[model samples]
Target: MNPYLEIHPEVQQALAAGKPVLALESTIIAHGMPYPQNVQTALEVEAVVREAGAIPATMAILNGKCCVGLSQQQIEHLGQAKEVWKVSLVDMPYVISQQLDGATTVAATMRLAAMAGIRVFVTGEIGGVHRGAQTTMDISADLTEMGQTSVAVVSAGVKSILGIGLTLEYLETKGIPVVTFGQDEFPSFYSRHSGFGSPLRLDSAHDIASLLHTKWQLGLNGAVLVANPIPEPFEVPAPQMEWYITQALHAAAQQHIKGKAVTPFLLKYIAEHSKGESLEANIALIKHNARLGAAVALAYRQF
Candidate 1:
């Protein structure tokens, strides 16, 4: 295992100086959205971290090597190129074996973030149990990674499209903590609340940093789930988004969409059905998480 990870020059200096560095995933750039906008959002989120006084480390696997931070050209390539694998922790070996271009998912990015010594990651939302999981057993690898990785995942809570309530319960069963930022209610990605109470809430990034530091000191492994809500002004009405989600999900089921294809399919349906509002909300929330994650990373660095 040649773990000779390559760090972008700026990220190298930042890490050397013990500066705050936030780990970002590449799936959003490659598999989550269409081109041009994908790359544009990627760059914009990086800029948000930079502006927030922390360095950004966008993780991906390019040409069989783990890239802890991407170059401008690499980002451009990821956006324009097709066939990028949505590499999870288990898929790393397969991706490397095939020497293929791959975008790291939350699970893959968290593993790489730990390997690169990053403490925090920001994304739209973590994946979880799919709807009606009792029979299908469909679950995201992210749940398992959270049990093993020593990193904090910041998001606008779980996407309401999934089994949000069940996902939280699953995390609890795995002994992973689900804490919300400044609120006790778990956010529902597009909405402010998932209609359920969060297990814990911490208002400040400093406080969240304390939780991470204390957990690591106690020798407990796994990551923290920070449910940072989307900005209110940008949030779509839950009722409205729900209408869009239901319609899209129904379309996906009618098409027999399964496995990895489900998310993209549903997202496309929602995007078109909502007149592109869904993607707009997705982009807004992601940028918001980047800023929050960067702040938390900065706080942790000071500690």
Candidate 2:
């Protein structure tokens, strides 16, 4: 166990009993959505996980501890607080040492979840190579962490604001398996299709669990990227989403948003400019991922 980690009693029990537990990131609550919606969605996602027969451990940094499994009040505080640091892999030590309120990004959350021995993690979307990474080298630490951590991540695919094709190439270079659930095409967060064929496809949670088990059992370590498409009805068309993403990227550049701040900034910008349609899709996808993550975790437990 990590010296800085504090697992909730329920989560600890689940781990001790070898039950399914899904690790969730706190950045979605604190930095991904606006006020009341953030808190509401966080709780609702947790409910979705429980309904699917897995315990949810929503992780964050609170008062110098890497707190796993937050309370409703704590979730509310994270959603409403104005000063929560958006902690990524590089910021974890500083935030923990300073005793600051911090919301863990995909990278940080995955690392913490691995430390706590949780195997599956759920999130709305993951950060990836920025559109112009060739010059700026602005790749997200999420990719690097996934390359090293043994946790399996279930997301609605890479955020549309990133360079999807390039991100896929990078993942291949890192030896990470990119599997799309029930689809031949890889999804781009807001939409059900990214125009690229999936490198791998699996149709059920049991199948995914089998893959995870085989990979780790054979000493092939590192995370598996499970891309779950947003429900068809909620999907924003790829072309329409690209326009919004372009505008958001311009706005981010104009504001000089860099590093960890860029994602939340771009997400907020798109949500606002799209008249909340994007936000709704974001919420729907996360809840959808929660269910699948739980199902996979449960299946993995059987192995």
Q: Global lDDT for candidate 2?
A: 0.94
Please, what is the TM-score per model?
A: 0.97, 0.99
**C-alpha lDDT score of every prediction, in listed order:** 0.90, 0.94
lDDT, candidate 1, 162-265, per-residue tens: 99889999999988988999887899998886788999999999999999999998999999999999888878788888888888888888989998888878
Q: Write candidate 2's Cα lDDT for 1-303 as tens digits.
A: 778999999999999999999999999899888999999999999999999999999999998799999998899999999999999988988999899999999999999899999999999988889899999999999999999999999999999999999999999999999999999999999999999999999999999999999999999889999999999999999999999999998888898998767887888899999999999999999999999999999999889
Best by TM-score: 2
Clashes per model (N, Cα, C within 3 A): 0, 0
Which pairs of residues have clashing backbones in candidate 1? none
Q: Which segments of candidate 2 are over 4 A away from where they belong? A: none
The top-ranked prediction according to lDDT is 2
